[model samples]
Target: MDVDNTKPKPDTVTLRWSYSPITYFEGPFRFKENNCCWEFFDGSATATINAKYPVNKSQIKNDLNKRIESIFNASLIYNHTPYKVSEPFMEGYDSKGNLWITPVPINLNLSVSGPNIVIKDSNGNAIEDMKGNRLRDIEEFAKLSIKYSGDPAAQAILRNYKSAVGEPNSEFCHFYAIREVLTTRFWSATKVRSCLNLKKDDWTKLGKLCNEIPVQQGRHQGQKYEQFRKATNVELEEARIIVKTMVKQFFNYLQNSESH
Candidate 1:
């Protein structure tokens, strides 16, 4: 049998995925890409892409994966906890309503607990606090990172923050990298301290804990193994708090500066 090869193909596709730990915002958060629209909600996200012609599904999947990973990395910086997404499954329909499926494997092991964090509603009212900071504040910081996604300095900060979250043994080193990046990008120590409302002594202590001390977690790379000692849990926690506060404050400063 002969077939006609001049038929038009579908110009749009939709990709869906499950993500965790589940987080709640005031409403669906939406953004636009080159030819795509991404909408993220409580526990799942969907991306709708428009193409002038049929495109490779594999390439679309890879691009979507990277985008989601970057967003989750930003979330990790703000929430101080990790967020993950399952592999995306793509679906679309032809002009005649024939469904096409690109069978991407999805393994969803979502937790049954409440939302990892609850952001403010559309009106910007504050929600309950998490880890001494408002959930809304966390959302705002993540959004700021997304807004500056194209900036090289923002990218470095995000990458280093992700490393800090992943490598507890060398977390102080990674966290300090974030500070260095901010400093290089024109955030002076005085500015950071003022933004975070931290005292000079406190800022000096943070530097000593992360950089000067000869601890296994510190940033002294050339020290002999015998010269370094394990950082206490209390010390690690203190450093984490200080660095996290600095990051949050920096992002907040960026947001305010952008507004005016």
Candidate 2:
């Protein structure tokens, strides 16, 4: 096969290939594709990513650092020497001891799973304990904790700032603040689910509410609400044991009587 050896090969860029957009909390977060290593008329090179997300180029070069490895696990895999993930980037090196600037093939991708995000946090005590708008449940709880912890006339500081540099009063305030935060955040919803025997669907309202968790936290409250609405086909697995048991017993009784 006659091939033109003149043109430079295309590079790989940080791009997301297999992802369900609905699962994300933010949008306008773009995805890219590159390294079509078979496009030119000469069949020499392909369109490809540029060795980094368009947002950051140096990220790939410095991805092998320890700070990145601490929060993220890095492994380089593929045609021999693999791709490694580093903070702010993922990079691949070829067998030739050279940086594989080409868009790393999907099968040869330098994947990074962590910096794991909390896809979901179900570490609360109870759900029924929440009131008001189901969508604002977490926020409502947070607001309550904050408001209740602060009082000028109160002897003990009720804030939850926990640090070594706290004054005597800061420590007291932080204690209650943390306690209330824990009870409301974890005990009220997630952790309490197993205790309550609540199935996943039983937590639908909570899930719906959680969808409103702003990807930007404080800024895009509206966007968070929209993201929840946009979440496609989010089904919760639920079971009512008593209901199931009763149905089984009824069926058995009918079956036995019919046989007799």
Candidate 2, after superposition: displacement of residue 35 in Å?
22
Q: Candidate 2 at residue 148, lDDT?
A: 31
TM-score of each predicted structure versus truth: 0.68, 0.16
**lDDT leader:** 1
Off by over 4 Å in 2: 1-103, 106-236, 239-260
Q: Give per-residue lDDT, candidate 2, residue 71.
A: 13
Residue 161 lDDT, candidate 1, scale 0-100 = 82
On a 0 to 1 TM-score scale, where does candidate 2 land against the true structure? 0.16
Q: Give one digit per residue, the lDDT tens place, for model 1 in 85-189.
A: 788888776656676776766666654324444467689875744533533454456557666677787778778888887787788898888778866777697
Q: In the order shown, what is each candidate's alpha-carbon RMSD?
A: 8.3, 23.6
- The lDDT of each candidate is 0.69, 0.27
| Cand. 1 TM to true fold | 0.68
